[model samples]
Target: MTDLLTIRGVSKRFPGVQVLTGVDFDLRPGEVHALMGENGAGKSTLMKILAGLQPADEGQILHRGEEIALRSPLDARERGILLIHQELSLSPELSAAENIYLGAWPTNGIGLLRKSELNRRAGEALKALGCDVGPKTRIGGLSIARKQMVEIARIHAFKANVVILDEPTASLTDAERDQLFATIRDLKARGVGIIYISHKMDEIFTITDRITVLRDGVVQGTLATGETDADRVTQMMIGRKLDAFFSRAEEKFGAEVLRVEGLGRRGDYHDVSFRVRQGEVLGLYGLIGAGRSEVVETLFGIRRPDRGKLWWQGRETAFPSPRQAIDMGLCLAPENRKEQGLVLGLGGRDNIALPSLRVFSTFGVMRHAREQAVYLTYRDLLQIKTTGPATALRTLSGGNQQKFVLAKWLCRKPKLLVLDEPTRGIDVGSKAAIHALIAKLAEDGLAVIVISSEMPEVLGVSHRILTMADGRLTGEFSGAAMTEENLIRAVAHHAA
Candidate 1:
């Protein structure tokens, strides 16, 4: 394989933080190069530089045997580079054909909305990628997997020589992932180089030819997939041996803290029945679309289950809204902290204390002194990376923003907590801190329900685990029964 692109001594610094420091990396033609790192390890920064979205403070990027200055995405696009971000960017109302040929449309002598021609071209593109999206169907009506297929189709439409995929299968099922791998294989057949970025060790081993590991804004090492195992690759990413990431916690149970019977939400969850005890961490295990999120959301009052009974402390409760759930000692720290969990436009103090807005107010006026005092306590406790409480969420790193999200919910001091993928994309340090907090919470006799796709995380913090399939509970296992093999078998059965 020949080097299609090379980055040398790349460095970038912000006002007070060094995001990337003297990094070196490369991408080869017709090869799938996997990039591995914990969050905040300069992976995103390096990709941004290659895509021409951000400039580096000091470095050289070589393309096709020439040192080049890519000022913008258009400049990179002209040089055959396409980046597919974690967040999907597509017009929900637009059809597949419209989104595929959005800006650079093939127009005739007199430009008009070309329907038949657009649909035919889009069908060909989708056919090439093995996508089943109707060219004229609105994107809003498509499933997440199908929409992702459209995004891949968009990449194929551009005919880019190099493609950057960041966490492409994070939100996909087993079947969807197989389909995506097929698409990648087809792309590789056409000699398109791909940079596969993810935290999934199994995925890198299965699909990528070579793997590059980064730690603390530096290259750890690069090894061929055939020569390295997942354990070795993980050790490289985290700088230590992780034989048991899913920790074996002590088993302690208290009185029933939360009980739900006959829970039913139309088109979502149905006939859900469970009880969470104090001093216990209940793990809800499922595939991406198996209604794991819906069950928790319904419990948190984000979605009201049409026919159900909720009991807290042996008393019936009616939670009409999230506020009601919070009032009853139930709260949720959502999965997507950047969007659903925190307000980027607001300062850290405001975002943290936003849930408890009523407490910081007297006669309908928010008091800054009260808010700042509370923020100070959590800032030190959570060790959030920020200049001050007044700093905006946007200015902080992804890990820091997530810390703030957890801080906000902690301020509520609820008894029953619903956490969805508590550490989706964070650094090792942050992950450790959050795990410690969870242990402390369970020790304090707080009822905690954790839902995570990461098997290690689920197995780490839970006293017992329940597997959900489609919309019903199918399996339940204790800490003793929690092994990688057993867990996979349970989820696979549910999927069937």
Candidate 2:
């Protein structure tokens, strides 16, 4: 397998930020090469350069052994290159077939768009991508995994020799991820060169042949996958060794703090029953669309449950909105952390204190110094990397922004905490810190519920794990028995 793509002396810079500099990279035919880095490590920048999403400040690109200047994705396509972005690009109203064969449509004998030809090619492309979505089904109704498959199918339909998947499995379930990996393998077998960008060390080691690490706008190093472990990769990305990231903290149980019975939301989930005692961490594990989020949302009053009874500290209650839920000492950190977690344009301190602004208000006058003090506490506590409490949330890294969101919730000092996909986009170091913080909170007698798609996460932090499939509680796994294989089997057998 010769080099199918090569980047030499690449560099990029924004107004106040120099994102990438003097980067070198190459991709061989029939290989799954991974890109690794922390959130601000220039991985996205380099990928944008390769995909023509952004032009290089100074560099030369060689595709298929020929020097080329790609000004747009269409130009890159002419060079047989395809990019599946971390943020998906699919029309929600369009059908899978329409999305796949969008511009280059095959026509019928009558010179009109051929429906049969569209479905046939779309179906074949989806099959090769290991996706089972219906060709004619509307894209909006499909799961995130299936939508990602649609994107991959569209790229595969182009028959590009060089394919780039940027964090493609970030939102997918384990089984769905395996299906994606299988598709990558098939592509490699068919002589397509692949660039896989991810922060997940396990997946990279398992699937990729080689890896390139970027840090602070420079190439850290490239290493063979067989020659490194998670620890080494972590060191390479950060230029230092990290400590242990998980701890099975001793949890103390108190009286039931949260109880739900016959919880049912119309067209969502039904008859969900659970209780979380003070100092308890309840792990909710489910594949995408498995109602894990719906159950929590109902608890948080994001949606009205069709039928159910909820008790806070054994007192029957009903919340019609998140405001009511917050008043009752409950908080939810939603899935799209960037979108729902923080106000991007606001200062980090302001975002952190926004949830409980009234607390920092004196006689209807806002106390700026008070909010600053609170932000400084969490800024040091979470080790958030920013200029100061006054820095805009958008200027911070993804992990730091997440910490700010958590800080906002912490300012409220809620009795019941609901973290949905809390560690979704964070790196290993931040993940460890967050998990440890969750455990510490639980030990202090705050009832906690963690809704996650990550198997290891559910197994790691929860004393009791509830498995959801579709919109129902299918099974419950105990603290000691929640292995990866069992969890996979449970999800597979019960997933809707």
Q: What is the TM-score of each candidate against the true structure?
A: 0.91, 0.87
Please report the TM-score between candidate 1 and the true structure.
Answer: 0.91
Tens-digit lDDT track of model 2 for 229-312: 888889888777877566555867999989989999878998999899988889999788889888888888778888989888
In candidate 1, residue 470 scores what lDDT?
A: 74
RMSD score of candidate 1 (Å): 2.6
lDDT of model number 1:
0.82
**Tens digits of lDDT, candidate 1, 351-395:** 988889898899899998999999999889987768777778876
Model 1: how far is 361 from its true place, Å? 2.8
lDDT of 2 at 493: 66
- What C-alpha lDDT values do all the predictions have? 0.82, 0.84
Q: How many backbone clashes does candidate 2 have?
A: 0
**Candidate of highest lDDT:** 2
